[model samples]
Target: MKDGNLDSIDKRILYYLQQDARRTSSSDIAERLDLSASTVRTRLNKLENSGIVRGYHLDIDYDLAGYPLYTKIICTAPVPDRDSLASQAQEIHGVTAVREIMTGERNVYVNAIGTDHDDLNRISKDLDALGLEIVDEQLIRDEYVCPYHGFIDEGDDPAPDDVDEVETE
Candidate 1:
C-alpha cells in the first residue's frame, strides 16, 4: 500500500526483514520486538499482499560463482516502449535485472553478468536487437546494500531539547 499506511510495528518488521530475510525468522523478530510470532507472520503476510515486500532476493556473488564480469548497460528507448523494452531485456541470456527510469534519455538500465567480454558483448547485441540504444556500459565492481534507516526503532523518542531546537528552526 502507501507509506502513510505503515505504522511503527510495520516499519520495524520491514527493517528486520531487510537486514536478513532468510536468517531472520518471524520467531526471531518476535523475540526481539517482544511481539507474538503469529503477529509477525500476519504483518509479513500483509506486507507481501500489499506489494510492499515484493520478494526476498539472493545477494549473489557472480565473481565468486565463476561469472567474473558484471556490467550495467544503460540504454535509451522510445518513451512509449521503455517499459516493454526493459521487461524484454531480462530475457537476454546474461541479463540479471532490468530497471526503467521515469525521466531521462537513458531511461533503461540492464544489469548483466558474464564469463568474459564476449559474453557481455552478446548481451549488449541482444539488447540492441530489442530496439534499445545502448548509451553506455560500465563494469560494476561491487555493490553495498542495507536496510532503510528510517525504519529502525531508535528505542527512544527525541529529547525535549531536540524538540526545542526544531521549534527554533
Candidate 2:
C-alpha cells in the first residue's frame, strides 16, 4: 500500500480474488482475515483506485465452448507496419490475444482459437494477408503454466531459502 507496494494483507486479498474474483465477497475476505467488512471494502476500493487491481475477468474454457483448437503464431512485420498489423490481427474473428515481442526472431505473437484444423488454417491465412511473415505456428497442446497464484507471496525479492548460490567459474 506504500508507494504502490502491496503489503501482506493486500497480497492475501489479491490471492483470494485471483482464485475466484466474482464469487469472493469483501465480507468473506474480512472474516477469513479477522478484519472488519468495512475495512476490507475500503482496502479493496483503494486497491482498485490505485490500479493495483485491474478489472476481473472470466477464464473461458475455449475447448468446451466449441473452439477446440488453440494456437500460437509467431511472425514478423515491417517496423513501420507493426502497429497496423497488430490492430488488424486483434480484429480477426478468432484471435484471442496478440503481443508484440521486443526481442527474438519473431516480433509478434498471436493466440487464437478455432473450431478445427480448417478453421485454424483460415485464421492463419487471414494473419498472412496482413503482410506478416509467419515464422512458426504451434498448437498449444496444454497450458501447464499460469499466473493465477502470481501475487500469493509478499515482497519483491525471493525468500533466502528459495535461492541457491553457485560457485564462480
Candidate 3:
C-alpha cells in the first residue's frame, strides 16, 4: 500500500471488492468504511498480497451464453513469429482472448465467440491456418465500452462543485 500507493483506505477496499466479491463482506467492508472488521481483514489481506486483488471475476453474459458471434481477429506474424502466433491463438477452438500487440499493425489480437456467421467463419478459417497474416476481421458491433466500472474516486475528495478555480494569469 505504500510503494503500490493506494492510500484512501486502500481505495475503499477496492471499491467494495469491485462491487460484490461474492456478496462483499469483511463485515460488509467494515460497515461501509467506518473501518475495523480487523481493519477490513488487514486491508483485504494487503489487497491480496499486493497484487492489487486480482482474482474475482464472473460477469459472463457472452451474449446470454449462447456465444452470439463476436469475432475480432487481427493477426500478423514474423517478429519471431509473435510468441508462436500467440500460442497458436490459445489452442484455437473459439479463442476467448489472445492479444499480443506490442504496438500496432496487428501483432496479434483475437477474441472469439461463435454460433453464427458460420461460427465466425470457422474462427476465420482457424486464424487463416495459423500462418498468421489476417490483418483484420471485425464483427463485434456493440461493446460500447467496458472495464465494468470499478475504480473511480472511491477514494473521494473532488466534489466541491466538481472543482474549477484558478484565475491569475
Candidate 4:
C-alpha cells in the first residue's frame, strides 16, 4: 500500500504467481522471465518479506469435505474504533473471515463456513452480541465449491458414496 515501490519485473512476477500459484514453480518463473532459479527465489522471498505475497493457499471444496454451509452476516453500527471492532469480531469462534466494506454507508461483512446450519446459527448469535447493531443478516445458502472458478458453483450434487473427499489433511 505504498507509493512507487514495485518495478515492472516485480509486478510481472506477482501476476504470474497470482494467476496460478501451484502451476508455476520458481524454476518455471525464472525460465519464463529469463532469470536463474536462485534469482527468482530471492525475489519471491523479498516479496514475502515485504508483505506483497501474503500467503499461498490451495482451493478446497468445502461441501465435499463435510463443510457445506457458507454463511455471510452483514453488521452495521457506529463504532468507537474500527480496528478493535475487527479484532473482536475475529475473536469469535467459527468466524473464518471478517472485512470492513464501505459500500454506500460503511459496514462490516462477516463470512463463516460451518458444517451445518446449527453451527452457523451459533456464529450469528456471536456476531449479534459483539456490540455491533445488525443492519442485515443473510446466509449464502448456495455454497459455491470449485478449485478454479469460484462464481460457478458445482451445484448440490452430493459427494460420491464410495469417494472420501479429504481436505489438505
Candidate 5:
C-alpha cells in the first residue's frame, strides 16, 4: 500500500475491513468475493506491512468513559524549525495530534481533544510561544468524526507528556 501498488481488489478489501474490523479475514472475504484465500491473505499482509492498515481497535463508546467533547484545532507556524515548534504544541493538554502541515501559508495543524473551547485555547498559547509567524487558525467547533477512519480509538488517549511525530503523506 505504501508503494501505491494496490489494485481494485486491495482497495475493496480495505473498504470492507474498515467497515468492520471485528469480522474480517482472508478466508471470509475470499468466500464473499470469490477470490482465492491466498490472494486475499497476501494482499492483506502487504497492506499491513506497508503501514496502510496501521492497526485495528474495537470502537468504544467514549461517552461512557467521560470524554464527551470532540474538537479540532489548526495551528500555523511560519517558523523554520517546524518539528520543534510542533513539539512544543504537543506538550499541552488535549493536544492529541500535532504536525507541521505545510511549509507555505498554513504550516501547522493540531488536532486536539477537549471538553471546552477554553481548553483548546489554553493549549494554543503553549504552541504560540515557538516564535513562529502564524498567518491564521480555524477551530472546528463542532463536527461528526468518522470513528472507523482515524488513527486511534476513543479510549487509547495520548497522555499530555507523550510526544507525537506526524507523518506527511
Candidate 6:
C-alpha cells in the first residue's frame, strides 16, 4: 500500500514496533491503544504483507561487542552504476550497510564496523575495488534512532515535545 493508505492505527502500530519490536507484543500495544490483540495482529500482518514493515532488526552496539571501530565510507560511483555498486558493497566483509543517494556526485555511502584500523582499511580497499572512489572515510562515534512521531494523528494524545518543528516555505 502507499503512504496515503496507512491510517492512524497502522501508523501507531509502526510507532510502537519501532520503540521495541522484540519486546512489544500485540497484547502490549493493545493495552496502550485500547485495540484488541487480534486486530493489532491483523494490522501487523497487513503491514508485513504490503512490504511496509520489512523486517525487524536488532540495534547492535559494535563498541560494546568488541568491534570498537565504526566507520562511514563516502564514495562516488557513476550514476548508472550506483545501484549495482551499492548491492555489491553489502557483500564485502565488514560492510554493514550501503546507501545509494540520488542526485549527487558522491552517491554511495557505506557504513562499516571493524575490530581495528587494519580491519577498516581492508573494508575501504574492498569498496574501492568495486569501482567506488573513496571520497572520504570518517570514524563514527555513535548512532541514534527514534520512531517517527508523524505517524500518530494530532487529534490523538500529544506527541513528545523533544522533536523540533521545521518550518519550510
Order of the predicted models by TM-score, top scorer first: 6, 1, 2, 4, 5, 3
TM-score of 1: 0.89
Clashing pairs in 5: none
Q: Name model 5 segments beyond 4 Å from true.
A: 57-64, 130-169
Candidate 6 residue runs with Cα over 4 Å from true position: 158-169
Candidate topping TM-score: 6
* Model 2, residue pairs in steric clash: none
Instruction: Quote the lDDT for 162 in model 2.
Output: 20
Q: All candidates' TM-scores?
A: 0.89, 0.76, 0.33, 0.73, 0.63, 0.90
Write the number of the candidate with greater TM-score, choosing between 3 and 6.
Answer: 6
RMSD of each: 7.6, 7.8, 14.9, 9.0, 11.3, 5.1
Q: List the residue pairs that clash in candidate 3.
A: none
Backbone clashes counted, model 4: 0
lDDT (tens digit, per residue) of candidate 2 on 119-154? 888988999998889999999865532334456564
* Per-residue accuracy of model 6 over 1-169 as CA lDDT, tens digit each: 6745998889988877877788779998787789899999999998999899889998888898999999999999999889999999999999888999987788999999999899999999999899999999999988887777797787777335313322111
- What tens digits encode model 1's per-residue C-alpha lDDT throughout 1-169? 5745898889988877776788779998797778999999999998998899899998888899999999999999999998889889988998999999999898999999999999999999999999999999999998667667687558744233322322110
Error of 5 at 118 (Å): 4.3
Model 1, runs deviating above 4 Å: 1-4, 153-169
Candidate 3 lDDT, 55-113, residue by residue in tens:
88765557878887777888887788899878987898888878888876688888888
Clashes of 5: 0
